[model samples]
Target: MRLILVNDVSTVRGGATKVALQCLEASKDAGLTCAILVGDDGEGLKPQFAGIRTVALGERPLRDGPTFTDVFAKNYNRRAFEAMEGLLQESEEETVVHVHGWSQILSPSIFYALAKHEVKVIVTAHDFFLNCPNGGLINFHSGDVCHIKPLSAACLATNCDKRNYFHKLWRFRRTLTQWGVGEEFWSRVGIVLVHEEMEAYLRYGPLRHFTTLRTPTAPLTPGPVEVWRNRRIVFLGRMCWEKGVRTLADALNKTGRTATLIGRGPLLVEMQRALPHCFVPGWLSDEEVARLAGEARVFIMPSRMPEPYGLVAAEALMSGIPVIVSSSALIATEVANNGAGLVFDSGDAASLADQLAATDDDDLMRRLSEAAFSLGQRIAPSRAEWARRMVDIYMGRSSFSAL
Candidate 1:
């Protein structure tokens, strides 16, 4: 059987693309016939994906700031449709298409193209795009989770887009086009959720058919870290309001704790101004981030939105670094229940400050670090094992397995 991977970018821009590239590498190593289709020119193809078959569209990502044409083209792109149709025509009879991401460039037109083919298609829910119009299920204006049913009167009337109502309207239009692709198209498609806990939000939408597939992440450290010697509290990811960077900054200020901010986003300037004493290095390489994480006393995932997975927090746990995560994140319950991390009220600086203070207990730190390492080892799978599981799903072997 032939397997094809589809995503918006060929390089590792974020967790979704990183997972896609890793899957591609693992699939090839497992002796599967695999190819990748991406929206960009594939200029930044990493060393591991060197010899793999790749199809790049040479299109600019809409996330890089949409143009006049991108405004309308994001809903449906004839170029992407034709490209997919042509690719499907040449593929083997028994083929599977696994899509990691598309909102950035490919658009919903690829779905229409897939509807014409007989191949099985699977989409990973890296975010809420399959259901929520804003792809976050967050009211950006209010900094709260949005409970309105998608496309309903309440949803349509709400201005939840980060930019403005016009952008929200555009997203609504795109979502309508996406869902209108017909029941037959959707019936044959299977959704892969990164975290099963995300079902709480997705079940309220039209698509209920799905399975959990945990992305593989190698542990940064070989074993539990020496948590007592470390003093830095680190927060990594986009510096945005939804990510709760401001909240983290406020908490650190209140506690007078030494913290490091690693990432670049709209809120970076604001965070820098808020915490003049803390380290605010813009963005670092993967190795640097991992090294920093290994040395950190605690990692923080201060997201205000309902993060589907929070991969970095999991990575921190795997590295034996305890985390302080927001209850709004899906992994917060697991980390708290496993004794791997502390859970703070989402968007609450005071609560986060209290947790920061609690981390000072040496015995408590040691226990939490050990538990965090154990939890990480338990959840993280080998690359080969993860690839085998992907093949099982592709070959129609299992569904409904929990991670």
Candidate 2:
């Protein structure tokens, strides 16, 4: 069987891109003929894909200084359509196309080309692009999660975009073009949700066929974290308003605790100015982050928005570090219910501070740490198991029924 992995970028810069590469590497290991289709210039392609087949469309993202051509190109990229059609034409064996990310560069036109092919198409719902025009299901203007049905009159009138109404209108137009691909094309498509809780938000979307797939997780570390002796709070993600970086900063200040904020974003300058006692290192490698995790008493995911799946929280849990998740996170209830983590009000600094204070108890810390480490393994499949599961789905041997 042949496997075609599609994504916006070819490198491991973002979570979605990393997941796509993992799928590619695993498919190759499983002895499946694998190829990659990238929407960008594919700069700094990883060494693992050195000899593998790859097609990189030399196109700029619409957000990067868009031109007059981008007005229509962002809706339906004709070049992407033709190129994908060519790939489908060349395939002689049964093929499966798994698309990871497309909204930024490839556009919705690739679906038009796939309409002509008889291959199976699986789209990983890494974000809410399948339904919400903004791809986050968030009201950027109000900084709140949106529940209105996508593309409805209410959705059309609301200026929920991060930019302005004009940008929202453009996104709505693009979403309409994507939906215009028709029911027939969508019939062959299956939605793969990274988290089971995602179904609650996306079940009513246009796409019907759905399956829950565990994103592969890194193996657990040898020993549990020594939480009782640690005092540093660690947060690993983009420093943005939606991520509740400001909230975390306020909580830290309230509790007189120092934290290591390990990420870079628009809020970097502001955070540096406000938190003199905290360490605001811009970004770190996975190895660096893992090393720092050993010294963290607790990890916090203080997202203001309803996070689809907080992967960093899972990583922290796997390290046996107790997590403090905001109620907005989809995994918040599970973490709380399993006694693995504490949950606070979404944007309440006081609530987050209270949770942070609770970690002072050595006995409570040990209990939470042990629970987190034990439950972390069930959050996602290992790398090899994820590959085998994908192969099963590709071969129609999956027992997963539509939700």
Candidate 3:
């Protein structure tokens, strides 16, 4: 069996990329031919997949465009779709095309090509772009989840996140184009993989055509307790509006607990202003972030948007730190179910403060910490296990039995 893993980037650093790489590894272990196609060449791209055969689509077009829309569309047109088509045709039959991310680098054109070639396709919903225009299903300016269907004009007109009518209209136009093209080509997709149950919420809406596969994630386990300390909280991932940095700041202010905000995003200045007591460490190497996670008392994922999965939260749990997250976050649900973390009200700083206050009990913290370690072992998919699963899928096996 042969499998082709398609993504906008080849780096295995992020959650989606990790999943893709795991699949590639799984494919190879299962005695299947595996190849990767990336949309661009970057420092992280090639090195991360050193031993694997990879094809980089070079730099995407319109990268220098001033507006987000212009740059996004240009890259989609120039790289994603074209590369997918070229790679698909060059590969042999019975190939499983596993797609991870596509919005920024690849346009809707790749779906059409897949449809034309009669290839078997499986798309993993790492985020919400398949059903929402903004991809996160988040209103950018407001940091709120978009409950409305992306196919609706109301969703387009509301300019949900940008809060600008004109910008909303512009977004709507682009989304409409993408949606129409996708519907025409992707309606026949064989499967859609989601990490949690919350993804089912989207099935009844606009993306009802595809079959849903709910895959479980493994949790993180901390190395040692020597670095652990009390009253030190950590925030990981992008510091953007959807991540609820403002809300996290408010919670910190209420609790008077200082936090280390690791990761970079568009809302750095705003987060700094709102939480003067908090430290912004910027983007750190995975090793650095893991080290910091070990030192922290607790990790918080205050995202207002629906997190498809909370890789950072898992890391925190693995590091023996408790995690506090919003109920809307899928990762939070997993954490709560595993008894490894606490869940707060979505977008409510007060609720987060309450959860934090409750964590002062050392016994409770210890119990949660232990649970986190156990859950981490269960949730964080090993490189070998992921590889085996991909091979099963490529071989037309009904389940990832080896996983």
Give one clash count per candidate, in the order shown. Answer: 0, 0, 18
lDDT of 2: 0.85
- CA lDDT, candidate 2, residue 65: 68
Model 1, position 24, has a per-residue lDDT of 76
Give the runs in model 2 whose Cα sits over 4 Å from its true position: 62-68, 219-221
Give the Cα lDDT of each candidate.
0.85, 0.85, 0.68
Error of 3 at 93 (Å): 3.7
- Which TM-score value belongs to model 1? 0.95
Which numbered prediction scores highest in lDDT against the true structure? 1
- Considering TM-score, which of the candidate structures 1 and 3 is the better prediction for this target? 1
User: What are the clashing pairs of model 2?
Assistant: none
Mind giving the per-residue lDDT tens digits that candidate 1 earns over 185-261? 87668888888887777765456478988888777666667886888889989998889998898898888887999
Higher-TM-score candidate of 2 and 3: 2
Indicate the worst ten consecutive residues by lDDT in candidate 2: 214-223
Candidate 1, residue 293: how far the Cα is off, in Å = 2.5
lDDT of 2 by residue, 1-403 (tens): 9998888777565678888888887788888898888888777466778777788898877645678888888788888898788888877998999999999889999888888888989999898898789988789877778999898999999999887899899999999898898877875588888887787777654577888886887633456888878887899898888889999999988988899999988799899888999999889887788788888899999998778888889888888888999898889999999999899998899999999889989999999999999988788787778888877877788844454
User: In model 1, which runs have C-alpha deviations exceeding 4 angstroms?
Assistant: 400-403
